[model samples]
Target chain A: MINKTINQKAWFMVLPVLALVAFNAIIPLMTVVNYSVQETFGDNLFFWEGLKWFEEVMRSERFHDALGRQLLFTLLILLIEVPLGVGIALTMPRQGIGVTICLVLMALPLLIPWNVVGAMWNIFALPDIGLLGKMLNGVGFDYNFTQNTFWAWATVVAMDVWHWTSLVVLLCYAGLRSIPDAYYQASKIDGATSWQVFRYIQLPKMKRVLTIALLLRLMDSFMIYTEPFVLTGGGPGNSTTFLSIDLVKVALGQFDLGPAAAMSIIYFLVVLLLCWVLYTLMMRNETN
Target chain B: MSSITLKSLRHSYLQNPQSEEDYALRKIDLTWRDGGAFALLGPSGCGKTTLLNLISGLLKPSEGQILFDDSDVTSLPPDQRNIAQVFQFPVVYDTMTVYDNLAFPLRNRKLPEAELDERVQRVAKMLSMQNQLKHRASGLTAADKQKISLGRGLVRSDVNVMMFDEPLTVIDPHLKWELRSQLMRLHQQVGFTMIYVTHDQTEALTFADEVVVMYEGQIVQIGTPEELFLKPRHTFVGHFIGSPGMNILPCDWNDGGAVFAGHQISLNGNLSNPASTSKLQLGIRPEFIRLASEGIPARIQRVDDVGRYRIIKAEVGGTSLNIYANEEVEIPSDSLHLDFDPDHTHVYCDGWIHEAKGQS
Candidate 1:
């Protein structure tokens, strides 16, 4: 019953953003696509080799190992950081001067640059010096991340948890603060225990923010390169060389542009698929 | 159901209150009989919610004691006090179904499943939500959510007092009447001591047997709805309760009673304390004033025809006053005068009404 006017001029308003996206994303992506489907040896000359690089990247053992490591690393950090961040957020004060102090402290880690975070952890987890490393060593633990595979994985995981758990904490803290005082007052009047209040009230209210925190952490941890690279540089016989590190090694380290381009597309697809699945699964129960 | 007695209950949000001005709730001494429906009526920031919170044990009083049928519950938390409160906005557990939301309080008490189910079912039926028991609480409309909140309170049998802090605020206009009547029927059926807090005079007067009018963190008056309508002890109640409110005219007190402008207005009786050195004013409701052929000289300024009646704005000696008349009453083009019914007119000293001799 309602008539909607169709105006073609609306496209003119979107032209600027469309052009910016083309320049920044679409054009660069086309170049990668061009390399992905062809063979390049030297000079500016390229030969048609359709699907050959894709097949090679898919069958490579190095690519599989890097992907497996990346998956494990992402899973481990998520499992550790989410619960830990929520716990820390729960303990943070809801009011007074303490709230500001706790918020500033939680935000300190997220404000640092990714490379700086990696570099700081690299020196901070060294066996001979650094507060954490020296204390662990003084407590009779052989903790040299530079040479040992187990210690290297431990240091990288710990460093990632330290550098990024604050993001989840800050998000969840905002979610907690958004809940009105009436909910708590009502729960108390309902004779609910502390655990029940957290389960029925706090947890349900924080679902949206927690989903955002998880998705952000999942994608960021999957594509992680700067922190682990600066800290360990995929050292100790490729134990910590994730997909991004392996891709860089192929594209820039060994100059295999075709396979690298193909692998980068696969990496991007994997991240996209994971994020899609996560978003769908988490949002399944929200009907409205 | 139990009687709730708040003995000299005072509250202050400040850690160290220096004076009476720092207190959010001043000295409040009140007692509600068992199974009584009471409404705390006030404007916003008038400490109505503070008083409700103090009684519900959501906030501790700065001083004084609270007794529920003779047992002191001042130190008890809300859970131990066995009091239930519905907030201004509905507070239903989003993840819980209607049945589960009603059963939450009983479950927290570790009641057996059989009794809990029975109680939840009874309350659900009372709220007319029996068919929606399986539906998620969050999916319901605002009115239904508020019903679930009230149902949660009603499910617990041992609740000493059920408090409502403007629970119908978010409800739709048509739904507010339905929910209010439903609450009245529920109160009759359950017989729980209920305290409803609101700034709305209609909600307060129609819902409660006794309405406690609060102003500036103090209980101004507590009386039946009829008593408040007929007689207001304080000028604030006279102004706050009625639509268009009572007209207060600055006057001088003399032996004839109260003198308004140059005319001596006859009051109900003589002021008990005539020697009190306080400023005097005459208080009379608009409905009690009539246009008479021979009375105080007045000029008709404006006439507003409401649905059932007409409000005539008149001026007596440069002071504005409102007079209500029947819609059929003929308006005089000129020589209009006003008459105040002696029985309904009272003299006010300062802000408090000076009770006439032989009148309670």
Candidate 2:
């Protein structure tokens, strides 16, 4: 055999990253994995639950209802925010002092704490004295979020859109600015109408950024709990009790750790699966 | 086909221009004849792009009337002016295929589908890009994208004028010659009025029938390549148009000859100095200076071999001068005498050529 020299020491460079992941993500995940397979009754006493908790959570109607509500909220907000964000970005002034002003104002909502956002909306939609409530009542509509299921759902959806749409706007605005002036000039010379320019030039250029915005909004909306928990507290007959709020109720409130852990794994897998499918579909046209 | 005229064209990027120096294009009045090939040759920051944009209707001139076939079109936009322009970097739609890119102009005009397809195929074949028309433009090389931009300009038969603003700046070195010759062949075949703007002398001299040389926001000279090489109308043209540019030397003038460094050089005609505050000097190309048996004595300084010719740097008076020696010529170590061609030499006053009284 021909002589060959090989060094196995390069594998050491990955040990540090492996250690960090073990502490930060893998170890915690394995703890949940352990708790998911067994039942704990008291100190130093355990029983093998096997697949019992998974079966129970899958058969529960509460889980199904919460999952349904979560899906509807995610779909509705995405439908509203992505297009509304892009429209606002299009109308925003391209440069000068106006750009700075609009960007700062758009960013104001995203910077507030989630609970604070929920609390602020809680007061702002109060039936008696809240500005929105008073305006709606003044316009002859019955609009009390605390007492009606439909109003609770609407208020929660509205709150998420107001809080998250600016993230999409900033991303889209950055994408629009990177396009060179030559594209517009060339299209002008080619006699393209404004609609044609937007359809061909602007939309195609914005596809990548828009994909990222969509994925981020989808994942965050799926895991949303703090804002709705603070505002509606999963109330008005459980109309807005999304998956996270339901998970917290079963885990901490009802003391059902095994079922909660099983549900958590299922929820994480759903988000991961959906994001992978959506990203693959959106990036289908790119050559690479 | 239509001739274009720019009348009293002036432009300033400033909101309020107070003086002539504030204008980017300072009062240019010129014409491009129908069915002519012209090049705007200038260095950077010379308002060449500004003038091209004005003609293409990208920028309205602050003060001028832009005329196409004697119609006033100063206020019109680029589409209304029927102008087509290719930028320095190729501006192709990345999402479109090469076929669709070529068909863009015609499609925008709502041409019949059959006619549009025919025109796109014709231009693609002319540019030798017919086979690659099915490929995406973003996936192609820079040269291929630029060919598509050129094809887009050629696809429209109704364009009043076609302009190129340094279109080959991004092309590979070997590909530049091929693209230039392709453009030349297209010009000869189509006979469309073309305006090419470039800072490189070779591209300008090879591409155009007439070269418009510019300097500092104003056009300094317009002539054939031969005329620009032999007799430059402006000192900047003489310095800018040739390899190793023209050499200029200061001298003391007498009635019939000039003296520099204790040598008397005879003049071919009666020439005198101008009385303006501008300096006057003798301008001669490096090719016209020769080493002879008896002439102005000078100390040979250094020699540089440039393959075909040896450039001899010699010091005569207080100035350094460059002279081209034939490759086969032997070097004289310490002593050298240089001769000037009196017929080709001219005096420049204030950066412009002063005509010799005896010649045109």
By lDDT, the best candidate is 1
- Give the Cα error of residue A178 in candidate 1, in Å: 1.3
Estimate, for each residue in A95-189, the C-alpha lDDT of model 2 and write its tens digit.
Answer: 88999999999999999999999999999999899999889989998998988998998999999999999999999999999888878888889
**Candidate 2 Cα errors over 4 Å, as ranges:** A1-16, B256-262, B357-360
What would the per-residue lDDT of candidate 1 be over residues B255-327, giving only the tens digit for each residue? 6567899998877656665555897878899999988888998988898889899888989899999889897
Tell me the TM-score of candidate 1's A chain: 0.95
TM-scores for every candidate against the unseen true structure: 0.97, 0.94
lDDT by residue (B1-360, candidate 2, tens digit) is 689899999999998999999999998989989989999999999999999999988888899899999899899988988888888988888888899999988988899999999998899889998899898888999888888877888998887888999999999999999889998999999988999999999999999999999999999998999989888988899999888888888866655566666677766767765654667777888889899888987788899999999999888877888888999888799779889998778777778887766766
lDDT score for candidate 1 against the true structure:
0.92
Interface RMS deviation of candidate 2: 1.0
Error of 2 at A57 (Å): 2.2
| Number of backbone collisions per candidate | 0, 0
TM-score values for chain B across all models: 0.97, 0.96
Q: Could you tell me the TM-score of candidate 2? A: 0.94
- Angstrom error at residue B157, model 2: 1.5
* lDDT, candidate 1, A1-288, per-residue tens: 899999999999999999999999999999999999998988888999999999999999999999999999999999999999999999999999999999899889989999999989988888888887898899999988888999999999999999999999999999999999999999999988889899999999999999999999999999999998899999888999999999999999999899999999999999999999999989896764
